[model samples]
Target: MKYFLAFLIFSQTLLASDDWGQNGHRTVGETAENYLKSRVSKKIDRILNGQSIADASTYADEIKSDRAYDEYKPWHYANIPFDQTYAEAEKNPKGDIVFGIEECISKLKSNKLNKEQEQFYLKMLIHLVGDMHQPLHFGLKEDKGANDFKVKWFYNPTNLHSVWDTKMIESYNMSYTELSASLPELSKSEVQSIKSGTLLDWVEESRALTQEVYNSAEADENLSYRYMYDWFNVAQLQMKKAGIRLAVILNDIYS
Candidate 1:
C-alpha cells in the first residue's frame, strides 16, 4: 500500500463550502461527477481500464477523497509571479502548479509505486483537478487569502483562507450522496469547454475571480448565520462549476 497522507483540519463543526470565504472551489465535485458519466464512451473506458489495475477498483473513491481537502493545501500560493512573469513562471520547473502536477504524474508513472501509490495518484489527481479549478489555488498574490490574516469565523476564530477551504464545505450538512444528487447536470458542450482550457488558463481564470471575491469581504468581518445563508448561493455555483470542470479534466485524461 502507498503511504497515504491526510491533511484535513478538524474542529467541533465541519466546514461547509457555503461558509467558505472564497468561492473558487464551488464547482469541483459536481464537475467530476459529470466527467465520470461520459467515461462510458468506449475509447475512454478502455483507457481508464488500461491503467495498471494491478491496484484495484478504489479509483473513483480515491479521487473523491483526494479532492476533499484540495482547496486547503497551501500550495500554488507560493507559485505564479505577480505580472507578466506569472506566464513565464508556468513554463519553468519551479512553478507551483507545474511542480505539483508533475510530482503527481511522476508518481503515477513510477514502476515502484505500490497499490497505495497508484491510488494516491488517482485521488490526488481528482483533488488537484478541483484545486486547479479554484482560482486561488492558482495564485494568492499577497495574503494567500488571509492565511496570514486572523479573524473570527462567526463564533469561531480562524483565518480567511481556512474559512473558505474547510468551513464552507462542512456547513452543507449533506452527505456526499445528497450533495451529488442535488447538483445540476453539465451539458455536453459545457463539459467540453470547461475542460478545454490549459491548467495555466484555469489558474488565470481563478486568479482573476479571486480579486473580486477577496476584495468584496473585509478583514475581521463577523461571519454568522445570515452571512452564510447569503453566500450559500455562491457556494452552490462553485460546487456546480467544480463538477463540470472535474468531468472535463477526468474525461480528457482517461480519454
Candidate 2:
C-alpha cells in the first residue's frame, strides 16, 4: 500500500505539466470568479456542468496523464534564452503558453464550437492564464523551465521549477480559498489596472520576470525561509493579476 501511494504520487508529478501546481491554479480561478459578472458566472457554471472554476482550473494538468493528451505537453511553457527577449527567442513550433492562451480565446469567441469543445477550451484558457503568470513558464530551454536547474528545498533535493510551482505554496499551508483571500485587496481601479494589458503585454511581463527567478538561486542551493521571504509576495501578486485578467477576458467573451 505504501509503495502504491508513492507510485501514485510519482506518476502525478511525472505526468503533470504543472505551473503553480494545483493549489495556485485553483486560487487564480477562485479569485477570478469573485470579480466575474453575474451573467458570466452563470454562463461559466453552465459550460462547466456546475464544476467551480477552481476545479476546472486544473483540468489541463489533470489531462496530461492521458497519452491522448500528449500534444498539449508543450502548451505549458515557452522557452527562451536568458539574454534574449521573446521576440528574439526561438519559437516552439508545437505551441507554448502564449499560443495556447490566444488560441483558447479565439476559439471561444468564434461562437462556433460545440459544447464539448467549448468546455475543453475554456478549461485550457483558465489553466494557461495561470501558467503564463508563473515566471518559469517563460524560462530558458537550457534547464527545461528550471526542472533541470537542481536545488534543495530546506534540505531535501528538488528542482528550481518545483520550488516555484509547489514548494513555496505548499510550505505556506494554505487552502486555495485561504490563499485567494490572503492576496492583497485591490481597489476597483487596481483591478482594472491588472486587466488593462493585451496577451502580448502579459506574456512579456512574465518573460521579463524569468530573469529574476533565475537569479534567485544557484544550482543545488538550499532554499528555505529566506527564499520564501524574497519571492512569495511576487508570486502572490502574479496569481492575483492573472485572476483579474482572466475575468476580463471571460466577461468580454460571454457579455
Candidate 3:
C-alpha cells in the first residue's frame, strides 16, 4: 500500500492541475447534481447514458492517457499573469481553460451535435467548470499555474499546484457525496449572486483569489494541519461555487 501510494503521487506529480483530483471534481459534479432541475437532470441523464454527473465529471482527466486526446492538454487551465486580466493576456492559440469552457458552452448550446459529441462536450464542461473554480487553475503563465511553485506538503515534497489540486481535499477524507453534503448552506440570493457572472467575470475572480493564495502560501514552507485548517474553508467554498455555477450553466443550456 505504501509503495502504491508513492507511485500514485509520483504519477500525479507529472500531470499539471489535473483538475482538483478525482474527489474534488466529483464534489462539484455531485453538488451540481443536487441543484439540477428535474428536466435538465433527466436530459443530462439521457445524454450520459444514465451516468450521474459525478461519474461523468472525471472523463476529461481520464482521457489524458490517450494520445488522441493530446490536443486537450492545454484545456485544463489558463495562465494570466498577476499584472494582466485574461482579456489583456495573450491567449493560447491551442486553447486555455477559459477558451475551452466557452467553446464547450457554445457547442452544447448549439443543439446541433450528435449524441456522442454532446456527451463529450457536456462531460468536459462539467470538469472545466470545476477547474475554473480552483484559483491556481488561473495561475501565472511563467509557473504553469504554480506547477513550479515547489513546497513541502506535510513534509512530503510537492508543488503548490498539487497541494491545491489534491492535498487539502484528499486529506479531508470525504467521498464526493459526503463532501457535497457537508458544504455550507447559502441563501437563494447568495446562490443567485454566485451564478450571476459571465465566464470571464468568474475567471477574473479566480485570478484575484489566486494572487491571495500565492501571497499566503510560501515556497519551501512545510504545510500541514495548520495550513490545511487555514485553506480548507476556502476550498469548500470554491467547490460550492463551482457546483452552483455548473448548475447555472446547465440550466441555461437546457432551459
Candidate 4:
C-alpha cells in the first residue's frame, strides 16, 4: 500500500501540468494562432509542409509531450549558478539557462548531429522556449522550483513552476487557432526585432525578469490566490509573446 501511495504521488506530479492551464502558466496557443494569420516567408512554409506558418499551429501537440516534461528538469538545472550565489544567474550565461538554448540551437544546426540527436534537441528547444517564459524556471536556490514551493491547485497538490509551465496554459480550453486569435496586436517591425536576437538572448530576458518580478511570500506557505491570479495574467502575456517570437525566429531560419 505504501508503494502504491508513493507511485500515485509521483504520477500526480507528472500529470499535474499536462495541460498548462494552471495559474501563472503561458498562452502559447494564442500567439501561435496569431502567427498563422500573418504573412510568413516561403522558406518557412516549405519547412512546414507547404502550409503557412499559421498552419503549423497543429504542431503544438508535438510541443506538449510527456517526454518534454521529463527532459526539461536536468537541463533546467544545468543553468543554475552553482559556484556562485543566486545573483550570478542574473548576470551571466554561465548558468544552464543561456547555455542550454545556445547548445541546443548549435546542435540543431550542426551537420554532425544525427536524427535522434536533432529530435531530442528540437523538442528541448520547443519546451525550453516555453520554460524560459516561466519565471520560476529562472529560479533561485530556495526551490530549484520544484522542492521549496507548495500549493493546492484546483484542489490537487502541486508546485509553482509546474503550474506556470503547463497547467495554466492548458486551462484556456481553446485550440491553438482559437487561442492565438486572442493575443494583443504587434507591429511588423516589433515582431521582426524580437525575432532577430539569438535564442540565448531570450533566456537572458527571462533570467533578468526573475529578479524584477519579486515574490515576498515564504516558500512553505501556499502562494496567495490573488498573487497566482495576477501572475497568470503575466504568464499568458509572456506565453503569447514567446509563441509569436518563436514563429518569427522559425520564419527567419527556414526563410
Candidate 5:
C-alpha cells in the first residue's frame, strides 16, 4: 500500500521545530517498505493513491506553511523536564507526538473516518512515528527541544536539535535510498525487540536518549567531525528502528 494518494494528503506541501528532517524521515519510510506485509502494502497504496510513504513522510511538516494546520505544531514533540517521567511530566495542553501517534492509531483502527481523513491520519502516523524517534523531538521544553542549546556544526552556528535532526545525516554523504539499502538486515528477533514496546515505552526511550544528546556537548561548542563520529550511528539506528517498528504497527493495524 505504498502509493495510492487519491483525494487527500494532496498535491501540497514541510518541517519546523522538532522535525526529523528529509533524509531521516524518508529513510524510515524507505526502510519500513522492506518489512511491510504484501496485504498491508496494497492497502497503503490504495489509501495514499500514488504517494509513497517517503513522500507522505514529509507532508506533516510541509503543511506547516498553512495556517489551518497550526494546531499540529505541538504534535511533533514531547519535551518534559529531565527528572520527570512522562506521566509525571507536565503534559502539553496542545498534545505531543505521543498523543499524535496514539490518536492516529485510534482513528485508523476505528475505521470511521471518511476517505480523506483515512489518508490524512495515515500520513500523520508516518510522520509522527519517524519524528518520535528523533532524540531532539523528545527534548526539554525549556530548551525549545534543544533549539536554544546552540552549537556550531563544523563552525556553522546552529543548535543540537538541528545537528541530530539533519546535519549529521547530511554529513554521512548518503541518500535515503543508499542509507536504507546499506542498513544491515536484522534477525526477526532483533526486529521484534525494537518493536517490543507500547507507545509510552517508546516515548520514554526517546526521552532518555534526549538526555544523552544534551550531555553530548556544552552550549555553543564548535562541533565538527568528532561529533558526527560519535553519534551518526545512533541516528541511523534510531531511523532504522523507527522504520521497523512502523512496519510492525501498520501490519497489525491492517492485518
Candidate 6:
C-alpha cells in the first residue's frame, strides 16, 4: 500500500511535467478570458461550444494518451539553446512550440479552413500560447527542457521541469480561479506592453527566464520554501503575460 501511494505520487508528478500542468494552464486561460474583446470572445465561445477558455485549456494535454497525437508531442516546447536566439536556433522538423503557435495563428487567420478545422487550430492556439509562456518550454534540446535535470522538491526526488511546471504552483494549493484572481493587476499600458511582442520575441523572453531557472535550481539540490518564495512571483508574471498575449492573438486573428 505504501509503495502504491508512492507510485501514485510519482505518476502524478510525471503527468504534471507535461505542458504547464492543469492549474497553470487554466489560470492563463481564465485570465485571458477576462481580457478578450467582446466579438472575439463570442467567436471563441461559438468555436468552443460555449466552453470557457479555462476548461478548454487542457485539451491538448488530455489528447496525449492517444497514439494519434504522437505528432504533437513536440508542440509543447521549443528547445532553443541559451546562446542562440530563436531565429538563429535550428528549427525542429517535428514542429516545436514556436512553429506550432505560428502555424496555428496562420491557419486561424486564413479563410480556407472549415469550421471543424478552425476549431481544432483555435484550441491548439489557446493551449500553445499558454505553453509558450512556460520558461522551460523554451529550454535546451539537449536536456529535453530540463526534464533530465533531476532535483529534490522538499526532499522528494523530481526534475527541474516538474518543479517549474507544477510543483511550485501546486505547493500553493489554489484552484485556477483562485490563482487567476490573485494575479497582480496590471494597467492597460502595462498589459499592452506585454502583448506587444511578436511570437519569436515572446520565445526569447521565456528563453531568458529559462536560463535563470537553470542557474537557480542546480541538479540534486533540495528545493523547498526558499526556491518557491523566490520564483513564484516570476511564475505569476509569466502567467499574466501569457493571458494577455493569448487575448492579443485571439483579437488579432478575429479582427
Model 3: lDDT equals 0.89
Candidate 6, residues 112-177: lDDT per residue as tens digits?
A: 999888878888888999998889888787888899899999999999988888999999999999
lDDT of 1 by residue, 1-255 (tens): 132222332221233231222223323543354456554334433544554221222233223335674543443344454464446654533345545655666665565666655556655554555555444454444665456555567668776666556665567666454555666556778756766767667666766665555664577776767656766556555566665655654555554
Q: Write the per-residue lDDT of candidate 2 for residues 1-255, one digit (tens) a residue.
A: 999899877877655536898889999999999879999999999999999999999889888878999898898889988777777778889988878888999999999999999999999999999998999988888788899999999999999898999989999999999999999888888887788878888888888888899999999999999999999999999999989888988999999
Collision count for each candidate, in order: 30, 0, 0, 20, 14, 0
Candidate 2 Cα outliers beyond 4 Å, as residue runs: 1-10, 13-17
Give the TM-score of each candidate: 0.63, 0.94, 0.93, 0.62, 0.92, 0.93
Q: Model 5: residues >4 Å from true position, as ranges? A: 1-18
Q: Please give the TM-score that candidate 5 achieves against the real structure.
A: 0.92
lDDT of 3 by residue, 12-93 (tens): 5445247688889889999998788999999999999999999898889877866899998799888887889999989899
Arrange candidates by lDDT, descending.
2, 3, 6, 5, 4, 1
Location of the lowest summed lDDT over 10 successive residues in candidate 6: 8-17
Model 6 has an lDDT value of 0.87
Tell me how many residue pairs clash in candidate 3: 0
Order the numbered candidates by TM-score, best leading. Answer: 2, 3, 6, 5, 1, 4
Poorest stretch of ten by lDDT in candidate 1: 52-61
